[model samples]
Target: MDTLSKLFKNNIRQYGMIIALVVIMLLFEILTGGLLLKPINITNLILQNSYILVLAIGMVLIIITGHIDLSVGSIAAFVGAAAAIMMVDWGWPTWAAVVASLVVGGLIGAWQGFWVAYVRIPAFIVTLAGMLLFRGLTMIVLEGQSISPFPSGFQKISSGFIPDFGSFGTNMVAVVAGIILSVVYIINELRDRRAQLKYNFKVISQGMFLLKLILLVAVINVFTFMLASYSGIPNILILLFVLIVIYSFVMNKTVMGRHIYALGGNEKAAGLSGVKTKKVTFWVFVNMGVLAAISGLIFAARLNAATPRAGTNFELDAIAACFIGGASASGGIGTVFGAIIGGLVMGVLNNGMSLIGLGIDWQQGIKGLVLLLAVAFDIYNKNKRSV
Candidate 1:
C-alpha cells in the first residue's frame, strides 16, 4: 500500500492529467447527447486531429531541447503547395512528388538550422523568419490561388482505410490487431516491471500494476471496437501509430534522446559533458521540417487542394498541445505519450463543442482557458515540489 501511494505521488502529474482528460471527455460526452463518441464521430476525431498530432510529436522533441519552431505551419503550407504544383500542374508521379516535397522540407530545415545552431541566432527569431518567408513562398508558388484535383492515389494518403477481412460481419482485422496490441502492451509493461525489480528500483504494487494494465487494455479494445464498427482503421491512424511508437522509443531509449534532454536542461553543461549541442540542435530543426512537410501533405490530401492559407496558426496549436501534454515551458521535461494525450484533449474539445453547436468564438476562448489552466497546473506543481 505504501509503495502504491509513493508511485502515485511520484507520477501525480501524469495521472492527474490523464484523469483531467477523462473528466473533460465525460463532461463533453454527456453534454453532446452521445454524439461525441458515435462511431463516425470517433473516426472523424482521429482524422481531424491527425495533422496536429503529427506536428505535436515533432514539436515536443523541439521543446524538450529548449527550442521552438514557429515555422512548421508555414513550411507545411509551402510543401503542400509544392506538392500540388508537382502532381497537378507538372504531372509528376505521386510517389516522386512526395519524395521531392519531403526533400524540400529537409532543405528548409537545414537552412533555418544553419542560422540557429551554428550562427547563434535564437531559434525563435530563425523560425519566425522562416514562418514569414515560407508563407510568402507558398503564396508565390500557388499565385494566390488554390491548386486541386490531385491524383486519386495521392488522395489515399489521408483518406484511405485499411481493408477488412476474416469471419464475422465486423472488421476482424481491426479486432485481431487490437488483441495483438493489447498483448504486446501487457508484455512490455511486465518486462519493464521485471527490469525495474532487477535493478532494485521502486515500483508500484502488483495490484496497482494489474489495475493499470486492465484499464489500458480496456481502453484499447473499446477504441478498436469503434474503428472496427466503422470502416476499420484509417491510413492516417496507422501512420500516427507508427510515429508514436518510433518517437516514443527514440525519446525514451536512445542516447541521442538523452543528449537532447541534457541539452535542454543546461546547454553549457551538456556541451561540457561532450554533447554536440550544435549538431543536435541542427538535426532537431531538420526533423521538424520533415515532419511539417509530411503534415502539409496530409493536410493537402485531406482537403484535396493546396491554398495559400494552408497551415496558418498550426504552430500555435502544436506548441499548445506540447505544453498541455505536460511539457515544461522552460524545456527539459516532456513525453511523447503526454503530447498525444494533450492533442487528444484539444481534439475532443473541438469535436464536442462543435457537436453542442458552440460557435467558433466561444470554442477558441474556451480552448485558450484550458491551455492556460494546464500550464498553471504545471507551474503550481513545480513550485509546490520546490517548497
Candidate 2:
C-alpha cells in the first residue's frame, strides 16, 4: 500500500493528464451520442491533428531546453510554400522537393539557433522575429496566392493508407500490426524491469507490472481494431508512430538528452560541468525546423494547397500542447510521450465541440481555459515539491 501511494504521488501529473484524457473522451462520447468514437470519426480525428502532433513532438524538446519557438507555424508555412513551388511551378519530383524543403528548414533553424546560442539573444526575441520574417517569406514565395493539386504521390503522404491485403471486413494488416506492437511493448517492459532489478532500482511489483502490460496491450489492440474497421492504418500514422518512438528513445536514453536537461536546469552550472550549451540549443532548434517542415508538407498535402496564410496560430497549439502535457513553463522537464497526449487532448476537444454544434468562439475560449488550468496544475505541483 505504501509503495502504491508513493507511485501514485510521484506520477500524479502523468497519471492525472491521462485520466483527464479518458474522462474527456468519455464525456464527449456521451454527448456526441457515440459519434466521437466511431471508427470513421476516429480516423478523421487523427488526420485533422497530425500536424499539430508533429509540432508538439518537436516543441516539447524545445520547451525541455527552456526555450520556445514562436516561428514554427511560419516556418511550416514557408516550407510548404517552397515545396509547392518546387513541385508545381518548377516541375521538380515530389521526393526532391520534400528533401530540399527539409534542408531549407534545417537552414532556417540553424539561422535562428545561431542568434540564440552564439549571440546570446533570448529565444523569445529571436523566434518572434523569425515569426514575422518567415510569414512574409511564405507570402513572397506564393506571391500571396494559393497553390494546389500537387502530384498524386505527394498527396498520398497525408491521405493514403497502408495497403489492405484483402477485401475482408477487417483489415488484416492493422490487426496483425496491433499484435506485433503489443508483443514489442510487453517485451520492452519486461526488459526494463529486469534492468531495474539488476541495478537495484525501485521497481513495480510483478503483479502490477503485468496488469499494466495487459491494460496497455488491450488499449493498443483496440485502437488498431478501430482503425481497421475504418480505412486501415493511415500512412501518416506510421510516420507519427515512428517519430514518437524515435524521439522518445532519443530523449530518454541519449547523452545529448542528458545535456539538454542539464542545460535547461541551469545554464551556468551546465557549462561549468562541461556541457556544450550553445551546440545543444542550436541542434534542438534545427530539429524543430525539420519537424515543422514535415508538418508543413503534411498540412499542404491534406488541404491540397499551400496558402500565404497557412500555419496561422500553429505555434500556439504546439506550445499549448507542451504545457498541457506537463512540460514546465520554466523548462528542464517534459517528455515526448506527454506532448503527444496533450496534442490528442486538444484534438479531441476540437473535434468534440465541432461535432456538438459548438461555435468557434466558444471553442477558443474553452481551449484557453484548458491551457490555463494545465499550467496552473504545473505550478501547484512545483510549489508542493518546494515545500
Candidate 3:
C-alpha cells in the first residue's frame, strides 16, 4: 500500500492530467449527445488536431529546455506558402517540394537559433521578431492571396486513409494494429517495472500496474475499433504516431534529452557542468522549425491552399497544449505524452463545442479559461511541493 501510494505521488502530474483529460472527454461526450466519439467524428478529431499535436511535441521540448518559441505559427505559414509556390507555381515534384520545405524549415530554425543561442538575444524577443518577419514574408510570398490546387500527392499527405483488408466487418488492419499496440504497451510497462525493481526504485504495486495495463489496453482497442469502423487509420495519424514514438524515445532514453532537462533546471549549473547550452538551444529551435514546417505542410494540404493569414494564433494553441499537458511554465518539466494529452484535450473541446453549436467566440473564451486553470494548477503544485 505504501509503495503504491509513493508511486502515485511520484506520478501525480501524469496521472492527474490523464484523469482530467478523461473527465473532459466524458463531459463533452455527454454534452454532445454521443456524437463526440462517433466513428466519423473520431476520425475528424485526429485529422483536425494532427498539426497541433506536432507543434506541441516540438514546443514541449522548447519548454523543457527553459525556452519558448513564439514564431512557430508564422514559420508554418511561411513554409506552407513556400511549398505551395514550389509545387503549384514552379512545377516542382511533390516529393522534392516537401523535402525543400522541411529544409527551409530547418534553415529558418537555424536563423532564429543563431540569434537566440550565439548572439545572446533573448528567445522571447528573437521569436517575437521572427513572428512578425515570417508573417510578412508569408504575405509577400502569397501576394496577399491564397494559393490552391496542390498536387494530388500532396493532398493525400493529410487526407489519405489506410487501405483496409477484409476483416470481421471492420478494418482488419486497424484491429490488428490496435492489438499490436496494446501488447507493445503492456510489454513496455512491464519492462519499465522490471528496470525499476532492478534499480531498487519505487514502483506501483502489482495490482495497480495490472489495473493500469487493463485500462490502457481497453482504451487503445476501443479507439482503434472506432477508427476501423470508419476509414481505418489516416496517413496523418500514422505520421503523428511515428513522431510521438520517436520523440518520446528521444526525450526519455537519450543523453541529449537529459541535458535538456538539466539545462532547463539550472542553466548556469548546466554550463558549469560542460553542457553546451548554446548548441542545445540552437538545435532545439532548429528542430522546432522542422516540426513547424511539417505542420505547415499538413495544414496547407488539409485546406488545399495556402493563405496569407494561414497559421494566425497557432503559437498560442501550441503553447496552451504544452501547458495543459503539464509542461512547467518555468521550464525543466514536461513530457511528449503530456503534450499529446493536452492537445487532445483542446481538440476534444473544440470538436464537442462545435458539434453543440457553440460559437467560436465562446470556444475561445472557454479555452482561455482552461489554459489559465492548467497553468494555475501547475504553479500551485510547484508551490505546494516547495512548501
Best by lDDT: 2
For model 2 the TM-score comes to: 0.98
Native-to-model Cα distance after best TM-score fit, residue 246 in candidate 3, in Å: 0.9
| lDDT minimum window of 10 residues, candidate 3 | 6-15
Model 2 residue pairs with clashes = none
> All candidates' lDDT scores?
0.93, 0.94, 0.93
Clashes of 2: 0
lDDT of 3 by residue, 1-387 (tens): 898787677768777888988898888889888998899999999999999999999999999988889999999999999999999999999999999999999999999999989999989999999999999999998999999899998999999988887657789889999999999999989998899999999777788889989998999999999999998999999999999999999999998998899989999999999999999999999999999999999999999999999889889999999999999989899999999999999998899899999999999999999999999988888898899
For model 2, the run of ten residues with the poorest summed lDDT = 1-10
Model 3 reaches what TM-score against the true structure?
0.98
TM-score, candidate 1, is 0.98
lDDT of 2 at 83: 93
Q: Which stretches of candidate 1 lie over 4 Å from their true place?
A: none
Query: Model 2, stretches more than 4 Å misplaced?
Result: none
lDDT score, residue 221, model 3? 98
Candidate with better lDDT, 1 vs 3: 3
Ranking by TM-score: 2, 1, 3
Error of 3 at 238 (Å): 0.9
**All candidates' TM-scores?**
0.98, 0.98, 0.98
lDDT of 2 by residue, 1-387 (tens): 577778989878778889999999999999999999999999999999999999999999899999999999999999999999999999999999999999999999999999999998999999999999999999998989999879999999999999999778999899999999999998999898899899998877888888899899999999999999998999999999999999988888999989989988998999999999999999999999999999999999999899999999999999998889989999899999899999999999999999999999999999999999999999999999999
